[model samples]
Target: MRTAYSVETVRAAERALMARLPEGALMQRAAAGLAAACADLLGRVYGSRVVLLVGSGDNGGDALYAGARLARRGAGVTAVLLAPGRAHASGLDALRRAGGRVTGADDAEGPIARADLVMDGIVGIGGKGGLRPDAERLAGLADRSRAAVVAVDLPSGVEADTGEVRGAAVRADLTVTFGTYKPGLLVDPAREYAGIVRLVDIGLELPGEAELEALQHADVAQLLPSPAAESDKYRRGVVGIAAGSARYPGAAVLAVSGALRGGAGAVRYVGPAGDAVIARFPETLVSDAGPAGAGRVQAWVVGPGAGDDAATVAEVLAADVPVLLDADGLRLAERDAVRGRTAPTLMTPHAGEAAALLGVRREEVEGARLAAARELAAAYRATVLLKGSTTLVADDGGGAVRVNATGTPWLATAGSGDVLSGLAGSLLAAGLAARDAGSAAAHLHGLAGRFAADGAPAGAHDVAALIPEAWRDVYH
Candidate 1:
């Protein structure tokens, strides 16, 4: 798992490590790693023109020290001090001793424009908002240059904890972060600004659990279920899906499409559109008696074009099994009933539904997606999947939240969410925890969606047809 730490936690860890080592040791380690990375980018340190945008904090210190190292190795290094008096005194002295020229920002624009490489040291974890006037001007200059840019810690002006960009931020070609990854480096909006991320371990022991994480292939493989040697169809698990109306029988087909492809032993579908589901997937066991009478299912998937049929909704909720709610089910769900469930519940909502649940505007949810997902989970006391450009899955128990980065923008089509809901429900039936099931299903769904439509636009059926290939790739 790739873990991300909050700014306060990173600071504490840095302090603990700093106390154990000699003064300036941590900064030296960071600077050395940074200098080595820059050397690789420049190909040869000698004769390369390097410019540092120095600010007023430890971030500038890291850049200055690294500049001194390059200067000693025959590179033409210059530091443009935005706040000369408040700059790291020791770093400035070291750079001067190593033959690096230091100048104020007023006279540094020409060198900055002509440099081969630029280091953005304008802000770090301690920064509150976007760039100051002087820093903004320098960032604009760097934007127009052909030189490769390296950010010292994080790209300046990004919210370290939430991954939200308050205002204009430096768009780095590469970000060399110290210790651990920040939340902003992994999420969108801010993540788009940070090009390729490289981590340098400066001897800070990180916490065991991170606030957020991006799942790797190994992590997903481990979480997914495989059938035992002696397992029978009845022994594995059964998933029941309640979906579709006469007007939207395709929703039922898509839901069953996901359920059959998901790693479940059998699928029992119950709804008014049973004949439509049977026509599409003849393997499914369909019943017109509704979800409650579907008989012995380990999990239930409700909603997805279920319309306003309160009677059917009640029947689906009556099942004593893990349940996943999506689409119209999300609209008709009573908070008290959802909260009173004995089994685990998962809710998958896009920005519009999440906005309704949180009583906030849709723009607010999109602006700060992480906060919106967490708040929705807490409000409904269920695992919440906030679907969009960057899919976020948040658990109500305050555990690690997951961000799915495998999806494409082409997934914004009809019945796509229904497929996701059924996939998650099937995983739940297979006995994975609610949070793991939701995230794992999303990962597979995204991969399948991409595979079905590699370079072209595909409808819902194409995505469903590619599920088997996705599962094979995961195992292989």
Candidate 2:
């Protein structure tokens, strides 16, 4: 897993590491890594024009020191000091000694425009709200500049803890974060500003568990289910899906579509639309009885166009298995009943449903998706997946929340969410934790959506049919 700690955690870790090392050692390490990355971007260190947008804190110190390193390597470096008196004394001295020129904010615009690269050091962990007036102007100039921008720590003006951009934030072509990943670097809004992220280890030992994480290929591969030679159908785990109705048989088909392709031994369908589900997926075991009489299952997928049948939803929820709730299930759910469940519960809600659950406006949920997901997880005491452009999954226990970056906007098609619900439920049956199952399923669903569409518009069934290809790609 690619772990992301809050800014406070990073600062505390940095302090502990700093106490052990010599003064300015951490800054030098950060600068060295920054300079090296810039050199790589420039293709050659010699004669490269580099501009540093220096702020008042350690972030500016990192840029100034990096500027000194670049100057010594035969690059033309200029530091645009936003706060001249408050600049890091040692870092500025180092830059001057290395033949780097320092220019005031008044002289920055022209230099920034002509530079080959710009280093953004306007804010760091200490930063609160958006850019100050002068910094915003400089950032606007950088935006118009032909230069490639590299942000130190994180793109300035983004909330380091929440990934929310309070005001104007620098859009960096690349961000080189020190020690570990920050929440802003992994979550959206801020993630959108940070084009690509690179982590530079400063030898800080992180403590305990992370608050957030981004899943990598290896991490997902490890979490994925792989059948063993000795395993039987029962040993591989079974998933039961309670979805669709006479009015919406497509929901059942779509849900079974995902469950059938998932790495489960068998998929049991129990709903009014069993015939339709079986027609689409002959591999599924269709049952006319409700979820209560569906026999044994490791996990249950509830909702997905079951309409307003409170009794059906309650039966599924009462099952002694990990449950994934979605669609109309989210609407008809008794909040306390879900919270009282013995088994792990995962709630997948779109912005509208999430808004209803939280008693807030849909716009609020959309505006700050990370906050919404976390709030839902805390409120429902369940793993919550807020589906959107940047899908967020949060564990109820305040552990690592994940934001899936693999999906395409084309996934907005009808009944797509039903497929995701079934897929996640299947993974839950396969013995993955709720958070892992939800995130992994979201990732797979997204890849399948993209693969099915392939840059064109695709129907929900197309996305469902592409699950096997997506599963193969993940394993391969």
Candidate 3:
């Protein structure tokens, strides 16, 4: 698992570590890492033109010290001070001693344009709500420059805790973050601004609970269900899918297709699209008696293309088993019913559906995804899996929100979300907790999408068919 800490938690950890270390030792460690990364990017430090955008904060000190390192290695380094008077005194002296020159922000453009690399140390994790006008101009200049822009810690003007970019932010080709990841580096909106991220361990010990956690392949492999010798179809767990309608039968087929490959021993589907589902997947245990008579299932997946069947949604919600609500079920299910359920409920919504539930605009939800997912989870007393470029799974109790970015733009094709819904639901049936189920399913779904697409467009069924491929990749 890749973990991220909030600014507050990180600061506390940093302060504790700094107290135990010698004066200036931590900063030197950071600077050494930053300088090394810059050297790697430049391929050769000698004769390279490097521009550092320095502010008054410690980030500026990191940049200055790093520039000094480059300067000593025969690079032509220039520090452009946005706040000259407040720049780190010792760092400034070090840079000058190493033969690096100093320049004001106004004189930075020409050097920045000619540079091989531009280091952005304008703002650190504590800075929020975007860049100031002067800083924005410098960020713009860096964007236009031929130099490969590298941001220190994080890209300037993005919210480190919430992953929100309210105004003008630096767009870096790479970001060198220290100690651990920040939520902004992992979540989207701000994640889009941070092109690529590299973590440098400054040796700050964090608490057990992180602000956000991203599951890698090995982590996911542990969560997958494997049958024992005594296991049968019933013993392995059955997933009940109540989806589709007369108008949209494909949703049922797609959802059932995903469930079949989702490690469930069997899938019991109940809906108007029984014929369509049976034709596509004859292995499915079809039922016409709705969720109540879908036989016994370990979990239920309600609503992908279910249309206006509030009755079915309510019936499924009343069941004493884990439930995954998606598509039309997200729309039709009563809020109070979902909130009052004793069993675990996983609500998967894209931005638009999430916005509808929150009574906000779609853009609002998209812009502040971390906040929106937590809010929705709290509101419904259920786990929320907000689907987008970065899929986040936040539990109602709230510890660390899980973030997954294994998907491609190709996963946006029709019925893709329906496939994801079934996959996640199957995991729920296999007894993973709501958060685990959502996170692991998203990881697999995304990998399957990538395998299916392989750099071209693919349909939802193609994605579903590739789940076994994704599962095998993770398991091995």
Candidate 4:
């Protein structure tokens, strides 16, 4: 699993490490790594023109030292000091000795436009909100430049603790982060600003529990279910999908399609669209009975295109097994009912749906996805899988919120979320915890979406159809 720490935790680790290391040794290590990464990006650094946006913090020191390394190797490096008097004194001296030129922000535009590379050290994790006007102007200049922009630690002006980008921020082609991954680098809004992230190990020992975690292939593979020789269909587990209405029968078909491939022994579908589901997957155990009368299922997925089926959603919520609430269910299901459930409940909501549940603006939820996810999870005392550009799974008793980035932008099509609900519900039936089920399902769902949409538009069914392919790729 890929883990990310909060800025406060990372700062503590950095301070501890600095105390043990020789004076300036830790910074030197960081600068060396930064220099190497820059060299790799430039290919041949000797004749390149590099522009550094130096601010008042250690981030500026890192850029200056790295610039000095490039200058000594014959590159024409220029440092545009945003805070001239407050800049790292030793770092400035090193750059000057190594033949780097110094300029103020007033002269930065010309060099930025002509430079082969621009390094942004304008603000570090300590800085909050957005860039000051001067730094924002330099960021705009770098953005307009043809040069490859490299951000030191993180893209300046984004919240490191949360993935919120409040105002003007630097957009880097590559971000060379020190010590550990910040939550901002892994989550969205801010993630889009950090194009490609490269971690440079500055050796700061951190806590075991991170603020966020993204499951890698190996971690996901370990969580995937495998059948034993003695195991039968019922023994493995069955997932019930109570979804669809007369108007939107395809929602039922799509949800069942995903459930069948979701490691569940079988799918027991009980809804108005039973006929539509049977036509697509005859293997599904379709029933006319409501969720209450449906044969035993280990878990249930409720409310995808369910229209106004509040009774079915309520019935599923009362089940003893784990339940996944989505789509129309998110609207029809009462907060008290969901919270009163003895079994685990997982709520999957897009920004709009989540905004409705929280009684906030959709834009508010979208802007602060991490906070929204956590708040929703805590509100219902359930696990919440907030779907978006970066899907996050957060549990009521939070530790590390899981983030999934394997999805394509093409996955934004209709019914995509319904497929996710079924997949996650199946995992819940297969005996994974609410958090694990949500995380693993998101991982698989995203990969499937990628395979289905290989640079082309793909329907929700196309994504569901490729789940096996995604599973195989992750397994092997």
TM-score of each: 0.94, 0.95, 0.99, 0.99
Error of 2 at 89 (Å): 1.5
Query: What is the lDDT of every predicted structure here?
Result: 0.88, 0.89, 0.95, 0.94
Q: Cα deviation in Å at residue 267, candidate 4? A: 0.6
Across 1-476, the per-residue lDDT of candidate 3 in tens digits comes to 89999999999999999999999999999999999999999999999999999999999999999999999999999999999999999999999999999999999889998999999999999998999999999999999999999999999999999999999999999999999999999999999999889999999999879999999999999999999999999988999999999999999999999899888899999999999999989999999998898799999999999999999999999999999999999999999999999999999999999999999999999999999999999999999999999999999998999999999999999999999999999999998999999999999999999999999999999999999999999977
Candidate 4 lDDT, 286-312, residue by residue in tens:
999888888999999999999998999
- By lDDT, the better pick of 3 and 4 is 3
Prediction RMSDs, each to the true structure: 2.0, 1.9, 0.8, 0.7
What candidate 4 gets wrong by more than 4 Å, as runs, is: none
On residues 1-476, what C-alpha lDDT tens digit does candidate 1 reach at each position? 77889999999899999999999999999999999989999999999999999999999999999999999999999999999999999999999999999999888789888899999988988787788888888998988898899999899988888888888889999999999889888777788888888999888998668978888777888988889999877677899999999888889899989988778888999988999899988989898777666788999898988899767766667667889999999888888778777788899999999999889999888778899999998888889999987788998888778988777777888999989988888898889888989888888889888998898898878888887787777778
Winner by lDDT: 3
Off by over 4 Å in 3: none
lDDT of 2 by residue, 304-334 (tens): 9898888988988887789999999999889
The CA lDDT at 195 in model 1 is 88
TM-score of predicted model 2?
Answer: 0.95
* Model 2: lDDT to the true structure: 0.89
